[model samples]
Target: MHSSKRKHIVVPLVLYCPLATFANTNPVAADDRLETVLVIGEQIKAALQAEQALTPGNVTVIDSADLYQRNIANLGDMLRYVPGIWTASGSTGDSTFFSSRGSNLDATNYDGNGIKLLQDGLPVTAADGNNHNRIMDPLGARYATIAQGANALTYGASTLGGAIDFTTPTARDTEPQIFLNDGSHGQLQGRVTTGLVAGAFDGLITIESKEWDGFRDHHQQERKGVYANAGWQFDDVVKTRFYFTYLDNDQELPGALTAEQFDENPYQAQPAAVIGHYQYNVETWRAANKTIFDINENSSLSVGFSYEDQTLYHPIVYSPFFSLLINTEQKNAGTSLRYNLHVNDHDLLAGINYGETTVDGGNYSHEAGRRKNMTTHVKNNADSLEIFLVDRWQIAPRWKLIYGVQAVSAGREVKNITVADGTLYNPGADYDSINPRAGVIYQFKSNNEAFANVSRLYEAPTNYELEDDSSPDNKALDAMHGSVIEIGARGKRPLGTHNKLHWEFSIYYAQLQDEILSIDNPTAPGTSLSTNVDDTIHAGIESLLGASFSLDANNNHRIEPLLSVTINEFSFDDDSHYGNNELPAAPGYALKGEILYRNSNGFFAGPTFDIIDERYADFSNTYTVDSYILLGLRTGFTHADWEVFGEVRNLTDKEYVSLFSVRDRAAPNAAILQAGEPRSVYVGMRLQF
Candidate 1:
């Protein structure tokens, strides 16, 4: 462990004192009022608070208030607004996947290649660092934050694309909340959350249940989950928390449809030979403790330890006649220690982390009768250290330079076992990389700033990619490396007397080396192999505009509006079978806009639109899917402690595909489209006390 404590002092001299006196002697501008200084100081304090929490890097925070306001139904829906994220659903609720940047959901075998999912700071992926889309549970999400790429090194897991942390409710207050809703497609949902706080003890619990008949034929789903959290504050230096979550879900998985099928009857079911069914059940328990020690006024040290246990059973229909059943049990335990030092103009953060993982599972390859059972066991051990230094320097009267560098060293090892044949394999791999990041912000007149940043990041290979068994001769694969350049500007301004506007515009370019690709060997059609490709490039622009206004006394109304757009271009640079084709599952553009209104009488109404451009289902781009737009409306009223709300989705009853299938090579040929949800209406009420 490295100590981050340091001391700083200014030399006292006549010349230096004279310069300081001259600087103070300068007259202040009229716009530089005391209140302005106070506001700026407050903002700086807030930023420092975030930095001190070891939450540096490129991070986005989505609070609970925003979740309720959006009425998000699932994990995919909840993350739709995030930049550089792509989500698709094959069935109503059972088949869903999420990808970040230009990566495909089904392509990467590593858990951290394009994205990593976490609950309460613990990884949710398998021990081999593979993420199973069918087992993602989102019913208990209270707050979430996302960190992109190598910036997420502190988590000590697969974080190639980035890392997402979902925070559940904590028991530190006395409150109770309930929500209910019913909508189109025979959808119904209910949720409850309650918490209690007494002296140094606090606890919270949540329960959620949802059911839907689904939009397409034979597409139905049932879901139920519960989460509980308890914490004890043992004085001001030590705190411990316990968390538990469980979920049971059963659903019908509707396969994709052909282009003709999509146009003719988007809600029609696939043939019996192609219909698929899936069921998933999971239970997880976690415990974490935090201890903070203040050595002095400007320096502090904190230590944390966490452990998690999870078990899952997933069965999916591979074809109409066959199904694959997978049973998994995983355990992860880790500890982290961090020290923070705050100086007059600089802050330093350093931490060390260690973890171990154990996985025991097997796959059943047949639908009925003495099915072939393949059991596997694997273990991973990791150790890492990271350090960061940031300086908030006042270059001039209105300019500040923010610069930082993060250095990390990590090593991981995997041990795998094959049950049937009693074969064993041990692959030990280790790598170290230095990620340097720098940015500058110039404060102009009014409340405006211009900022730009460039960073270098590296991604390691996942366990699956290292030991897929598909390639017997090639057991070693290189890691993925990339760099990103970003430029953006954001500002807040007041419009007239009753409104305010805030907006941001950014453009980024990313280049990846040693990009992983899974291809079918030319001589061996049935066996697919994984290897690193030459290169790939992704470029995109993202923009957001938001405004809020207040109305006159008679109406006593408030209105808030937001709009966002993203344009992306993803391509490969290689001479392979695919040839300069568009990356699969990468949408060209996405647009979303919404308006919300509230009146003094406790009435609210809002309308929203979500649109996605045409996209390809495969790298070859041989097949194309038509683009679609969806319309939704929501309204509600509240009286005292009771509230009622309703929402209608797909109001026009337009049919479209929610997901596309690129793997099936039958009649669909190039692509198979899954129908989107049809028009549905839901009404619900909630009481808070």
Candidate 2:
């Protein structure tokens, strides 16, 4: 699943369809669509929230408001406050890597594969389960749902880390605006968005351009993108929406600097990066649609399909004589069908999602920027078909039992056209897995609930991970499988007339077989090697607490304190060499907190802090990435249709590593670390009409 490209596609942000724009053009149509909006709003938000609460596993729904005006640059920063999700980024806004509850515990690179990413409940992650962060545009989304662990069975997401579905906004929530941000590191951002409605159709579109002179030398970057959606209603019972997007991205690679180099000149590029002009470039196009049909008062059917095409060009220094040059084209297509039924006290959902992705790739031997010769060429293809069923039964007014299952069949095949060594390729394999989940939710009181669940998950090896060139076996690697048991409680309630509290906490433990471990290729910088461990254990605790207080009349003055933490314990169950050793890159503790204040006159301010415990940098546990703390502040003013925000990151100007690479071994002088961004300031403004 890992390509070492460190980029995540941002397509999902454009895949959502919100047709409310059309109803706004005509008063009669507006009134006609109002009923549909009310019903669909539940389909888009409230119902999803209610469904999430019914899951015994940890699940969360985040509104776009959480990041809309916060100067979010990427998913890494976008998900900073989220629990159980940890990210390691190469630059302030570059590509990022993530791990949820130690799921890919030893992954040391930026490719996010273990976590399932969806666009409006359809696959954004490719057939092999690899997802790049390029498809997401934070400001263009309506909200997102995070289903942790087995709770993702409804989406047929069998990965240990679960799944995320990002929904887009409708005309009702749209505000046409122009925005810009100019800040430290010679960064500049400009964007324009518009929404409109006419008759039975609605449409919204956004265009953006950005450039950054990066914190490090020779790491300049530029990007241009367009996102748009149009939705139409044929009649009261049938409606369809279409999505389209285009993105162009080019980023210079400063590569990694050694610890000593980081302390000396963190802004300097790696030697190879400077000499070979290392970089990555991408061009993409995507189109998708979702249509809903009201089957009856108590049931509805939804169907969707999408297609995407991408071109990638990358050059990296893998060795002194032969840096790797990659030219590839990827095509992806998927379709989804889901039926929702609510009959009496029973709720059921049945769905089938299918996707296929093909890669036409070529590897080359290069000197500087020119390819000296072709190494190999191949067509690698993967496909996935999944059927899932979930049912929630109300046994009593306050108690409910939920059960779900997913049947998945997946295959990966590679046809090599050039002569290559055995270890350089794998014929690939096919896999079938059955995942089952059960949970119970008990409402102890208003706005409060206790829940528990047990589930099993399975994840197959990705195309890249099957690169065990040493074996001629069609299936070079085995699938990773696991079972998890979890219990938790969550709720929100008012303590007094002027104060309110919201809290949630959960603990989970899992036993796994053939757990995958990402091992660095010591001989080639940035290259990876993955293998399976016989047995492993993963456990974690996640919690969030927030309290709000109103201090004056009209409820204008308000104050709040927010706290979040995650504790992880992942280790080898038994191994002769590692011997019950904790997994590398798994932080023992990570915490975030904030104190915020707001005035009735549309003014607000907040100070936030993040702290991470020391983490092992390798399997041997001989080297480590030290703990670091970051302090930041955000202030904003919103009056009528005008919005202004200012953000200061690393208020202390503390120099640190926002993220680092884990490998077979590490040293002070090797290229294995990325310096955290220096203290920076960003000021932004948006005007809506």
Candidate 3:
């Protein structure tokens, strides 16, 4: 069952219609396309241009241009150049897992523990507080910003490690663009975007579709989506906009590999696994309305409301011998409101959000060509509120001081109903917490900045973690919390008359409480379950450096080089079970570097390299994965009304594990490992008018 309340209001368009036409709405000019084009290396610049002042923090922007240049097809591929972020490739697809400053990657089971993912400023994680399998739809994204530690206080909820915001294209200009790509493994993708502008009124529409045969056996995925945006500006004082998106996806589940299978062949897919019979399908609809009011020339206020509905289903095989069958369904809805205010040198922001999720399913076992069934249901609800303030004070003509604080309150409730032994067991629990953040930054010159801050964030145990009533009653195990401290600096310098260099570096430390840990409890003294442990700490350093140089007499021909790296140290503080051990899926170091050459004719070419140090599969550090490196190349050309590009990923054909096996004891039981994809290539063309 689903329930919600709403109040509808209609505004007369007669008064605003004529004004909309005279509002100087140049659709393409007002849009963020150009901003997206420079996002990858100029994220800080874009933020500054948007009036988002940064203190001594590490922030990175990944623009559409970077994505195109690198042929990034998924989150893993896109984040390879971002320091402090680690990605794992599984048979199913790509997953991102990371530790910032010294937080355990598994503290909350790697489902976006220390980081938050926002789609157009709305949370995309499910009610369970996990975003592991969620596809971000890179094809639909215009720009993304990653802010680390306390620097992310501007956004509410989960800011211990960082916050990531992915903004879609808005109606600002009038243009039409199309893109197509074909790659190995039967992979293909297509996208189209069009815009219209009439005075102060503008609109944009986009559609994208993709299909892939996958690198592993029995693995296939298909996805498609449409998005639309409309906007109206009432002079320089006020503006309003609407956005909507619809998506559908279907994929095959390939399951995890066994340890033996891993030792024999890390790239082999399990053909006879029960998981091979499973398929997952999902559908989502989202809409938002936003308003910007200019309180005056120096201050503005922003408010918005967003709603999203998502449905998912998975058909699974229950047993290997008997060939049992089961299917599960999940539905979710969420709403949020936010406001922004700027006055003098101070900025203030606040927001509130709420969401509801429900799961229903039935289990069936195949016996003598007959089906035996069981039914179940689960529900969860979440609510949150956040408030923050930031100030940029000019202490002197050449120095600036920045500071801010944020407070957040969050709560969740979960309910589960399962039929067993002719009786239905109904159990539920609720968890809640308050988090706080504060940070400061100092600017020494136009090209230099430094800062430090401390923040507290928490993760409510997922529905699955606490839904079982058989577990011992332990309040301390209900939630995970982390406290982080960080300091860093960034600056740019002219290396020559026609060359400029920029660099950013940061170091952080974190202390965690009631960290969740998964255990093998097959023969435990009580019911087999995953539970929480207490006291852990993680720390690390993250850095980025780059330079741009003119290659010819005309500044139009240039070369840009970039490098990024992250190193982490993770350990359990109170228990000996995992003392002084690296967290699972936590890579100790990663390096990414690239060089790009561009000419005046709108042509560009680049080569890239990605390297990762060894990592452990578990907290015990008993099993280790060796380091690996990958090479890639891409080139693009733009003519009067057309643009074309091609890219090759993993050109060296390196084999590595992007994701670890969560089902260590499951059937078809290869070693609980999932292999990485092989070498692949993609080519595409686009037209605009």
Q: Per-residue lDDT of 234-321 in model 2, one digit per residue for the tens?
A: 9989999998889887777787788888879877888887777677777898899999999789999999999999987777765565
Tell me, what's the RMSD of every candidate? 13.4, 4.8, 7.4
Instruction: Find the number of clashing residue pairs for candidate 3.
Output: 19
Estimated TM-score per prediction?
0.81, 0.92, 0.84
Q: Tell me the lDDT of model 2 at 43.
A: 68
User: What's the lDDT of the predicted structure labeled candidate 1?
Assistant: 0.60
lDDT head-to-head 2 vs 3, winner: 2
Ranking 2 against 3 by TM-score, winner: 2
lDDT of each: 0.60, 0.77, 0.62
Q: Which candidate would rank higher by lDDT, 1 or 3?
A: 3
Better of 1 and 2 by lDDT: 2
73-154: candidate 1 lDDT, tens digit per residue: 6766677666666677646564456666665433342132466566665555433345643255554665676665544544
**lDDT of model 2 at residue 532?**
75
For model 1, what is the alpha-carbon lDDT of residue 682?
Answer: 71
lDDT of 3 by residue, 1-689 (tens): 01111110002222323333333334435335434333432554465334433554677766664465445567776776677776666655433444444333542343455566777666666555556346677656777777775566666655456677787665442245666667787677766676766678878777676677778766677777788889999998889888888888776666556667766776665554434355556677878777878877666666666666666555434344434334445555555555555655555555655555555554444442234554444445555455555565655665455555555545555543455544433334455555655566666777677777777767665554554323554332457777888888878889768889988888888888876655333332111255666777767888999998997766889998889988877777857565555566666788888888878798988987878787766556666666788898878886655677887778888877766632213334324467776788888776554
Error of 2 at 457 (Å): 1.0
Q: Which lDDT value does model 3 have at 472?
A: 56
